[model samples]
Target: MLRFNKWSLTPFHLLTLLLTLTLTLWLLNVCFNLPTWLLLVPIALIQFLSFLFFHTIKEKGNIAVVYYCGYALVIFLLFKWFNSMAITSLTYTQWLGSFMMVPQPVFAYFLSSTLMLSSMFIALIYYFVIIHFRPMVLILISALPATICIRMGRPTVSSYLFIFMGILLLLYMYYCSYEAEELPYTVLPCTKSYWSTMSLLLLCIFLTCSLLLIPGSNLSNPIHTLLRTQVTNHLQPNYTTSTLPKESTATSAPTALSDTPIFEVRATKPVYFRTRGWDYYEKNAWHVKREALSLGYQLPKSEMNQKLEQKSLVLLNVIERLEKNGLLQDMPELTHLLEAPISPITYYAAYVTTLNYSHYMYLNPPGLISISNPFSPLDLYLNALEICFANDKTRPYPNEGYVISYMDTFPASNSREMLLIESLDPSTYNQLINFLLDRVWEQHNLQQAQEDEYFLKKCSDEMETATLHFLDIPNSITKRTYDLAQKITASSTSTYEKALAIQNYFYNGEFTYDLNSPVTPLDKDAIEYFLFESKRGTCVQFASAMTMLCRAAGIPTRYMEGYVCEEYDASKGCYIIKQKHAHAFPEVYLPGYGWRIFEPTIPATENEKSPLSLILLLITCLMFLFILYFLSKVLSEQLWRLWIVRQEPKIALEAIYSRLLKRLKKNGYVIEVSMTPINISHILLEQGIDLTWLTEHYCKVHYGHCSCDKTVVLQALQLYKFLYHVHP
Candidate 1:
């Protein structure tokens, strides 16, 4: 007890030691993968014992030191566990690809090594002057910058930082010692003020980072594309593609996409992308038909336990705009709808949602674009096929060379070939061409219809026939919208001219696109969202609306879902379809020829107006931002103030000085800050400065272990204020 000075092992010295040990252990772990757990054991044991046995007011100074050091130790060990788990989860190769996203182990080293070294620097200065105040602030500020730099670079940076810090700590200690006359041990410590300030800063920082780390309500997929080489590089140092040897193993089957470039496609025209199919729509859900059962039909099963197969042929291409649906480049075309195809033809399709680990079809349900059965008599049929290649050698989970295949088996290829050969075999090739030409010319009898001034009659005839088949439009609204369509195409005479005009009208009308809507009908019986609830819907709604309206006008029309090109690609030299665009248009089925595609949704006005409310929305959003920012600032400031107030001073000499001052003033000798409390107390004892009041108050406030009386606290505060001014 005689050798123990409360002034020794000050707050500044304790913090310095803590920062030094933490940084060293962290760096060693990073460079050598050394055991960080071993270093934490003794630090933890000492802290536990210190807290259990040395908690009294007389030993409170030591306890505070132990507490901060213990905190630093626990943080280090926890980080070590996190680093080990992170590293173990990935292969050495995967580490390189993941380096930037999760740099935890590197962070651990910086936190441990720099913090310990910085604390040591501060501790030396504290040893002499014993004012742990400003140095603590300096150390914290420097630590942040150090952490950032070390994280960006190598583990050795932390070692260099600590060594330099050690030099600075020793130099600062020498300066403080020279500046002091007899050392400031006679001056009492303000342990409460120091610890309080440190605690507040730490609390504020922790709270701030925690809040920032919390994710917002909405989230999106952040990972897009990663290079395979990047993953391999981390595992193997100094690896290069040119230097790496290639695999020479021979296999009977060609690997999927092995020789194919990642981004290679030969199609110049837009085509639908095809994945697997879901044929069963039940319980408000669409499910893929298991091989054993489909729409009330069981497929044949073989002794090998495999189900009978359905052959299907499907062709698809990546669309530029399909990413909006979260789909990849490949999509399924055949069996996309319930109806059978009318011909062996190609179509485009865009589907939403990508695959997960399990091979299943997940739909975002956004409408896909596709085109099928342009003009043939026979309908197309489709069934999914699973084909697996025999070769692939990637690591981890074995890469399977499996691909989804679509087959169209009806009106078999052999039958179609026979039909074409029999039809043309009776005539010479040139004679067959001449006969087709003569038939086409003979059907041009419509040239005389213009002489009858029968344009209006023709329109009415089309409308009447269309109403009987598809349209549910009332005569009055039908006339008005039809006139609106005519006003759009008032100048057109030919089929192309009329088609463009109708396109302009629908584009200009108050039609909307919606993704989340119940199925509704169109035409004279157009299903409208509540008359006031106007919003642009998805492609399905937009296409359905146009088809119904055109049918009411006596126009031959059909809705087509297929890929549409968003832009004309210079390299591809055509409109490249990145995504499927479902479209509905009028198709005039002519007498001699077949149906031709017509546009109906094109707006006459180039700048399409959006029906959205904007100003009020902006003001509401700004107000939310201001409120969140204000609350955060206020919380941070108040928490800081509380932390500073809670600090307990290290040296009991300050309490002793305070008590002696109270006694001196009561005994008629005015105490001052410039006057050392020890010297003043000695003089008073020699001259008898009656200390009865002070001894009683000090015992009650400092050792009674009960709440201090307000009166006594107020008296102490008044005494310190008076001494501060008088001593200065």
Candidate 2:
């Protein structure tokens, strides 16, 4: 039997419930695009009824059955009465205050059915988030709807994130409430005194506001973008059924690829039209790894057998370990570290027209932005492609084809094309790494991630998963391949630079691009064979070698293949793409940009850039630093408090004494280092100021040689309060 706890409803409880529920409803609506009143009105109604019903019922299960029955009967009557009205007019917003305005009674039925569903959900949220403060249950309930929406082709992740933060707060609130004796209310964390509590509260206001307000836009989210990348990589292949040639592969020997024209492009400039990016490379094959069966469709048996090892999907356990141990005061540094730089993105459109009926539609590298056809469109921060997975007869693309928009950050002329700044200057990243390492081990994070449920893991774990998937090298890849990659990119600092260096390495004349190359040995990895022994292969080998080498050099790279439409028919205005133009290349996942396509088979084109990117980089850096300046004051106060608390009694007292003198000096007093505590007190008294209490304690510890103990420290804390809390 589901039950409520003994705790009474407090203001903190109500506020937590309201904020969490608001976030939950917003995300749920994003998932289903539910009518505002349909979702809210029912949930609000259920909350009131549940509050009333919890007092009356011994059996809570009976209420759900009754609500659902009411829904079925109401729907039946509405549908029968309004059979003539279209369902489109039945939207909640379509009607106003009058029943006559909503001629469609079927809307009543839809409302009733949803009302029943909302009652059941509100009951769970009431039990978990509001009453019991159980994060796992609330997270489970919130995640299910979001997951369903993603699979149904509507992916909105922002809702789930807000709820996660809310859970942390409520969990902390639960801990704070334990100090009932000291707290004046049901929830604020109690220090020993009211003034210290005031200090703590002010500090919290600074930290929380800094965190929630600073992180802007959905682009800051990598898991959200990576999810789109994973979705496109897996489902896109199932759409194009024609034996039309696919490009992402490396064969030991070259075969005469057909020169027949496959697709035509109408664009301002030439672009590499990629079918999709393959993250896994093994046995000379660019494989799209199947993490699991996805989008309600099963992969072919050949592809399904070799699945990547499933990883932990959750971060709550690791967070539980981290938070349970830290004083509730640990969030300041986290907020300080998390603020990253975001640059603006501008998008350009590329039109792809198919000439052969069997040819697959090729998209630009970061994946699809949007297609012209009325297909499964989605809004991702990364703006990735969402391909139709229905059977060929019912596929979304038409015979004429679709247009894909590429972001300016697109590496190929184009494309986060997930990251704004991968580490945002290594200092912040190092701080994060050192903090994580100091707290936990590598194996623990992974284990927790493996056990985590979908859509409920850490940002770091998902970020790790997305990057590491592309970095894996099969055993066939030699150490020399790794060494060569590292050696070539030795001077490079960023992913793009490393990628550029590796791309240009092939052009150094060490490898040959031959269509009639000799077959590579079965004993060697195809890339290793090409780089060392054979040294004579086409775009296939060059692309594959660069892909592995980049991975070895600690850069996440994927092999991409599709037709290159460079031959422009200027009179016709669209570039003519041929089957012979079917090409393969390496795409490196640049930190600030999204997945970028690089031409490693030939010398990389010297990508020209306007001064805007440099200007954007400098501007973003300044903004990050500007925010950091404010966050630092909070951190400094917190650190000083920690420093005072942790030191020896004499040192703690001296620290407070030194701080008081510094504060006075800042206010324009010309006190010397040799000034006596008595002399300072006299000068302060002469100026109509009184810090006699603070100076007296410091004088006892320093001049009288009186012992400084916990009592003296408390007195010094009172002294510290007058210096900071009473003044500036």
Candidate 3:
């Protein structure tokens, strides 16, 4: 039989047990959505029974208790699982649907269970193998709850409190261990030092409450935006689709437009900020099919026109700032610039403020110009004139600024002449057609050889097959798209004329531009519904309709998303881009010429600010100020306490003595303020502390006419330290 001492059930032991139980209950409440009262009853019962059995049972009964607790916990988990009839009866699809519905609580429960089981197992192993229970084990257990909270989305105040308490418990245990070595018979002072325990508990509560006052709590706070980009940009994908893609990609438009400036672009002329270009359209969404390949920096020619060379220098200066601030790192290697032949044009400079996407945005048909701060490395997805950077690791840092120099290219000057073939006489048209066909055949043979070499060399297959991909359309396209395209361009002769006719069809006020339009039926094709049935949609619908119409008309096209540089900031001498400026448009491929931008949708009217919106904004500002004021008040109180202790030594001593008396009384000592310091010292002597010299110093400072000296203060501090470690 194992003999239990009275000190075994010390206040420190009970407090630690209570804290552990509370943490378990709190996790169950947050993760499983279990009621506090429901969890409290079972947890309290288990803790009480465990404490009772621990104190009463001999060593032989330890294994039985462990087995019983484990079995009971398993039974409880099984009961909870089987209780949910909806979960039990679910088919695979139904199960998946249900899982998504309750993913949060389910994940939370799993995390909580794992933490509890792991803690128990760790404790049991330490006790059996090492012959002692180490409180440091709890420190490791703290990580589980913190990780679970972060995985659930964000860290809550409760999660942080759990971590803080675990740390506090570990420190207390360390203190106890040291005391045990110094005085083997001494009991834990946690209960004896009642005032100190209560003070620390209150402090923890105050700190936890302060955390809750922070905006978004576990989500993005004010400090986060100031330090880095908005949390949403880091977590979510760069591009998103909305029912009305033209209006907003988000579910609904924000009630009030945020004046938060996203980025500033400094350029001679305002240009479209193109991020990504999409090729495939299906079920109201646009997707990229090919993966981007990484291409390291390829050096550009230093010798160029004087004007372009000057612009490149200026761009390099801006890139230096971006790199210095840890924004842009290195440049990307483009396939067209490396493998395919390209002609250079004029170089231009732009200083951009924020980077929301992984790829660099540039004006279409970029040539071989050098970047100031390059991407760490670059990933290239080459499909016609559509170039994209897919390496997120090397992308620009979020919210940081960047500057780049890019050379813009123009299509072949005779591109228009090729389109003018339909207007020529039959002899001229046939002769021109034969010459072009023969030229195309010769180019095809050369391209085939290049492709074979590219494959043999293990070069990017996507870039080699770019033209084939540009012309490929999904087989899901309905006959209505082809019929509509033929009807619209029936009078048109050339490919350019057909594209112009299709663009005109949408611009002719036949389709309404509605941002708040109802979602298209899922059963119907998005482009078909937008074109034939619902002639009302946003930029997404309009762009999709045009892309499909052009494809049906034998004109290859690609869908693109970027910002329209409409609003210029005159004060900044640049363009200020906002989230509202995000737009989607289509690029039409001309055989000889590259992809050309053609706007099909009418510009949307700006939303008028309402009086109600202004009132809400004002109220929100006031509420924010109130939170700041509340936090200031809490902080001030704590500071005031420290000031009082520092400035008034005599008053501080009295307060400490009063707290000591309360602690003594809690430990079953009959302490009274009326008693002299000498009498108090006599009672404390029974507990093995000699405070006679400290009592005389206290009297000299308070009762006597003598000023308090450093020696007296030092003695008081030493006495307090000794008393702090004394057990009942």
In order, the Cα lDDT scores of the candidates are: 0.33, 0.52, 0.49
Candidate 1, residue 337: Cα displacement in angstroms equals 33
Q: Which candidate should be chosen as best, given TM-score against the real structure? A: 3
The TM-scores, one per candidate, come to: 0.27, 0.38, 0.41
Evaluate residue 630 in candidate 3 and report its C-alpha lDDT on the 0 to 100 scale. 50
Which is the leading candidate under lDDT? 2
Ordered by TM-score, highest first, the candidates read 3, 2, 1
Give candidate 2's total backbone clashes: 13
Candidate 3, which ten residues in sequence have the lowest lDDT sum?
Answer: 219-228
lDDT per residue as tens, model 2, 1-728: 22334345565546545644565465445433344554676566655565445434424456856765664576456544543343554444444222221123344544544454554555565556544655445556666665654332222334344555554455545434442223433545433453464445445444443432232221111112221232233224343322222223465553433333445566777776665456677766665564331222222112111111111101223334555555224655443322333233445676654432232233543434444432233221111121223344433231244556654433222111123233222234334434544455333355643433222223334345547567888887878987888899898775666788888888887776565577777666777878888887777678788888988988777776555768886545567665446676777755433356788886322442224334445655665575477457746875788778788887888888888778778867768878778898888888766768767777888888887787777677665654553343
Q: What is the Å distance of residue 663 in model 1 from its true position?
A: 30
Per-candidate total of colliding backbone pairs: 63, 13, 5
Question: On a 0 to 100 scale, what is the lDDT of residue 241 in model 2?
Answer: 23
Q: For residues 1-728, could you state the per-residue lDDT of candidate 1 as single tens digits?
A: 21235445543334344444454444334433334566566443443333223222334566766765665576557555544544245543355444333323443443344334334433432332233323344445446535643332222223334443453344334333322222342332233543453345444444433332222211110100001111121211111122211111100111111110111112334333322222222222123324321111111222111101111111111111122233322323211221233234332232111101111111111112111211112111122211010111211111111111222222233332222222221123224233323332233344532321232233234333323333334332435556555565466544333544555554555653332233323321222331223424343334444444454444444443332333343542323222112222234322111223444433223332211212223433555465456447645644543443343331232354464466447647766667643455566657654344544555554565545544554444444434432321
